[model samples]
Target chain A: MSTIRIAQLSCGTEYSGVQFEIESAARAVGAKIVYPDVSYSQVKEALDRFGFKPKSTQLQLMIARAMSLADRKFEADAVFITTCFRCAEAALVRNELRRFIQENTRLPVVTYSFTERLKAAQLLTRMEALVTIVTRKELLARERQSGITAGIDSGSSTTKAVIMENNKIIGKDWTPSGAVVVETAEQVLANAMKEAGVEMKDIEAMGTTGYGRFTVGKHFNCKLIQEELTVNSKGAVWLANRQRGEATIIDIGGMDNKAITVRDGIPDNFTMGGICAGASGRFLQMTANRLKIDIQDLGAMAVKGNWANAKMNSYCSVFGIQDLVTSLGEGKKFEDVAAAACHSVAEQVYEQQLQEIDVRHPIIEVGGTSLISGLVKAVGEVLGEEPIVPPHSQYIGAVGGALLSSGFL
Target chain B: MKVFIDPPNSMVLFDLVERFGHEPLSSMAVIQEKIDNIEVDMPPMNVTLDDVVRGLKYAGVEVPSGIRGRMSLWGPMIEAADAAIIIDNAPFSFGCVGCDRSNELTKYLIHRRGIPALTVKYPTDEAEAKIMVGQIKDFLGGLKQ
Candidate 1:
């Protein structure tokens, strides 16, 4: 495949001395940054035609370049609009240019506001996402698994592995994530292979995902290494049997949470971030440890409990656990305390994430937390609709990898 | 009725106001007038001495020429607005409005204009976008045409 040309549309990148960071980020992903060529006359014409006067000549050129891209005067695979964070006018123009390009072309667009302190590492993920959108459009479009494949998820809290043959999950295994990412991945993959009674040679293609995807992918020389947003949403819809319709996917992981809205198995919109771990699986693990029960059994305990009796704060994980301690010390029932923890997590997810999506029917909940009946129940109760917690929800990343990697086979 | 939107050239607020049957008083339109008036020899350097004097009424002489130049367009739009919608905490990309002093002065002028102004947070997702649109619809519908 040829190198993707991402049209750079921005102001002050050169002046702020961060142009090299942008170039290096694109180069790291096997892409090249191309500036849309604009003449002085074209700049003047664009300034006159755009109907907004910017004080900087660079801004005028930026407008003209955006017009050039929109007019098909420049050919590129994607568009990256950027401006300094300090420039309010540049911010407005950057957004306007992004909207203009999206309206005028089918090109994928990613916009950023950078500071002088910007690093190439900060821009790598955005560049990689753009490259994925451009290079893997066909792989992303594949709806089902084909041939024999395996997937590994080197997650933050736990590592998971899955093996599939001809669209069916043959075997899977999961364990607590280890200090050494590659060793943990190797063990999980070996365990899963043993369960499936297949040799490593039997697996035709392999894929890796999660936080340590790049490190593990490099170690294993996998066929696909993808970001969790697209891969997880794909795996989720595939597992829930909602490939043909619109559905919302919710994944509450150890450190962060994701809420994505998908249409026909392709993710059109997604929001992933957590201000605190209060809304993640790690918080629940803390809650279970405090209660002196097995993490797996906390869900059943919470089911028999009523959350209203032990209201807890859902803002910070530290404070949330503090509230749990107080509730338990105040002679609150263990069941109620457990239920409140589940309710607190559910409420936080609703407040923080669910509001970010239009929320289609049949929400498919996937993630390690999905197996906890209390969390699943709370999510359903808070959403006012039961989410379909598909089988093997904890191995979503691994399953998604296997499902997507099979397309390459 | 002319509706003013802060960041003065936001396409989203402009389209929403226009879609509901009102003129969106914005810098783009004001700039369009200056750009299209071919009587001025220079195309974009349309800020006249008279325009600079008008801008001084909104901002101080200590302010940057960029702010003063922008106020020349935004000041008139704010004065001409029958109603205004000001989006708060809008992401930099939503409408850059680059000059901080100019943005603050513009918002102050719009608030002091005493029109029925609606202030809203910029929606981060589709659900919030829907709610924002509904709020705009209600605010516009309440106006006595």
Candidate 2:
């Protein structure tokens, strides 16, 4: 297929990550980026009618397709499209484009604002630590020996990104994933590339996954993508196999959870976890912030010997806090209580898994909870072993992504 | 389509408005409400049309069909300003004085117009107006083609 061409339509003004994602995800695959805007006057009119529902929708539909008629000129095999949700300035225009996308374009048209993609990426990582990520090395030598491949996995909470030069980390960077997922992700990759001193053209193939993937995908000329899950798997495996070898990946994020089994150097048996709030990294992150603690220190604190019984009880984080405070009032140590909280999560997770399949080996925690030592220990104690937390465990999905782009497995 | 810009409040005409008897925000509110409904009523003053035109020129706006002498005709003056912009708070008109009433009136002047009139709040707005002038020039470029 001709270079994978992706398109992003956003608040023609705001800084969204769609462009950045396309730049990083499509780098190895030789992809191209396209940002299209409707005629300015048409866009203005669309925005002016934003107050009127029918008029807004009609205007948005028109604006969405305003300049999209030119898509025929591009030699693309598949077209991924994205728009901005809170584009107050371009609200009318985007509605028109949204309508146009709904009407035409058969390339599995996944249409959502960048915000949705950010949510989905987060959801996918939460469901499972994507075990197989496409990776591309910078050079033939490095590509063969180092098996270095770059994967830019831009999700909602944070940008989990990595670039491998020789199976050795050339450079890695993570930033708060912006509202513009693709654009910010790509910018992070660009920054990583500069920090690593790797030229952009050196990137052999690019694979973008998650919600922001489509908008970013438009910018990449080629990539291997089907859905957010597939890329997450590819991403998880590429990283999990490195740390745990046989990877039974669990990536829990702010919104969801996922479980995968990779055996014989391939994803063999896999069952995605149920949609659970307790399973997400972001929820834990918010909790940490609520408790007034830096998230990075959670694991270290869990390692402390003095254990307070965790006050958190009801699965909801807000109610869980009162549960935690009550435990403290009853005289439980913070470490013990936090660890117990972790145990509860693990028990809840394990219970859910028992409904699906037998518990496998090498469960790697990925996401916000994975970093909390108390939680990791609590869950591990229930599961009979401490789950492995690797360097950049939170970035497993992105690592798997780089591996996927590499065409390594 | 006539538009008048009110200068920033720190000017002499503000005092004139106070001298003429009108509340600032009330005047602004009334003018805005009127403009929203697309209506206009000009208040008479001792200020001459020559004073307005000469005053406009000093403020860096060259009005089309410049007004002559100390003419105080509000109807034709508003008519002359119908499609044109009246610069608010011109350096010459308001000078450096804090007159609330007149300042508010000047701001309302642009809104009083049925056409689009904008206050140059930021340098960017001014730049945009200049850009419109340049764009018009470019549009005229096509006639040569």
Candidate 3:
């Protein structure tokens, strides 16, 4: 039987973890995911053709691309939209695009709102359910076939590899990415291959996605390379599949922060901040080092301490470390100081990146930083609501890459 | 004596006014006050709907309403000045599209006010800059006399 095809649209970022989950879910349900060849220039062309001047804001550009995507030709049974939450612009754009799709096409459209607190089980259930629903009508139309595929996600901090056979994840491996990304990608892929008991000849297809994906793909000679935002959004939605309403995906990585709004099951819009490490995991790591504490322990210490009154006002990581030292010398308890540090990062994100965005509830936290219990707690306190953190959040990107190889060759 | 300066944020004019021992009236102070008291996570201070209404009310001109709102903000400052110095073709002075009208109205109001006003173009070369400074010095000195 011919495999069902799903077209994925998103602003590609490497950290969101949505792409991995969507691919996995699609593969499990006997479907193939395809990405469109839409670019900003094409979007501009479409806007010009429609007599619309280019807008200065990034959200407007993304919306323009989405509007143009509707007119472009591609073969797919369904359309999925993924975006960040709390984006006022995305909310406005999504409403317009939803109407455009309704008026222009008969294909089923589903939008997933990705946030930092999305659960893997919820995402998987929804994806599996989507696949079932999409494929149900054509069940007797095609013959079923399955094979093995591999995905490698070479992120800033780590390289992850996952091998899948007939939609189920059979084997996966991850290792710290050191000085040479090429070597790390090779090592991780080798490790995954060994565990899966499969050779290069045995794998049907291979795909690479992440920050270092382009470099790694060139070194390894892999043909299929996907954008990080596309895969991460896909992965996040697949994981948070069960979520029924609007949510924002906040991925705080080592050096960057991503906020993706998922409305329903599709990603709507996204914003990113990474010019400095002040609003990222690097900030927390640096603060922990200055406190002479392990990074992992900072969160627990923060929870026990009361430093709501103490201020760490520096937005630069180096300046923040100085602020931490000054606070400690001023007789502030270590626990309180640490908690305050976490609070400061949260505040910076709120003030800088998310100020214009009216963030929706049930914030889903992802990326490696989401593991920091104290930072999560601080973000909750700042937002005046708790977030959902799914298990194995770091591997969502890698899994999304693997799922991309699903469908007919 | 109060002297009004165009491109209200010009530090050069502000410093010259203080150096010449005069009170300089500009919109920078008002803008700064708004920025200082802004609520966290909100859009940065800019010309807002309220400012437009207030400016229109102050200008009391109905035709060519496009620039009336902005002109109102500068009208009161020009009215209180003993004299005015307008630096033409100033860097970063490409105001919004409607600014031409605002500029026209501002100059008209200053003319009507009947204050001793000096309009100077920003110097391009080092020699022109020196000459421009001399012209400004002479104008202020004449006012002092």
- DockQ per model, Cα: 0.03, 0.01, 0.02
**Candidate 3 TM-score over all chains jointly:** 0.50
DockQ of 2: 0.01
Tell me the tens digit of each residue's lDDT in model 2 across B1-145.
2222234222332333333332222223333443565433333323333344433211111111122111112223333443222333355433322433223223333333444333232223667657644443343232221
Which is superior by TM-score, 2 or 3?
Answer: 3
Question: By TM-score, who's the top model here?
Answer: 1
Q: Give the TM-score (0 to 1) of chain B in model 3.
A: 0.77
Question: Model 3: per-residue lDDT, tens digit, A273-391?
Answer: 53368778889888888888888899899888875756688878888888888888888999889888888887667545553234666687877777788888988986778877776
Between the candidate structures 2 and 3, which one is better when assessed by DockQ?
3
What are the TM-scores, per candidate, against the unseen true structure?
0.63, 0.45, 0.50
The lDDT leader among the candidates is 1
Relative to the unseen true structure, what is the C-alpha lDDT of residue A177 in candidate 2, on a scale of 0 to 100?
Answer: 77
Supply candidate 3's per-residue lDDT for A183: 89
Tens-place lDDT digits, model 1, residues A1-409:
9999999998889989999999999999999999999888999888655644466778788989989998999999988888886565675466456656766787767667778998998777667767887788878778789888999998899999999988999889999999999999999999999988898989999999988999999998999999887788778988888887889999999888878777677665455653479988889999999999998999999999999999697578999998998999999999999999998899778755554345788899999999899999999988889999999999889998999999887
Error of 2 at A373 (Å): 2.4
A337-385, model 2: which lDDT tens digit per residue?
Answer: 5555555566556544322222457766665457777777766775777
Candidate 3 — what's its lDDT? 0.64
- lDDT leaderboard ranking: 1, 3, 2
Which ranges in model 1 have alpha carbons more than 4 Å from their true place? A7-23, A33-76, A79-119, A303-311, A350-362, A380-386, B1-145
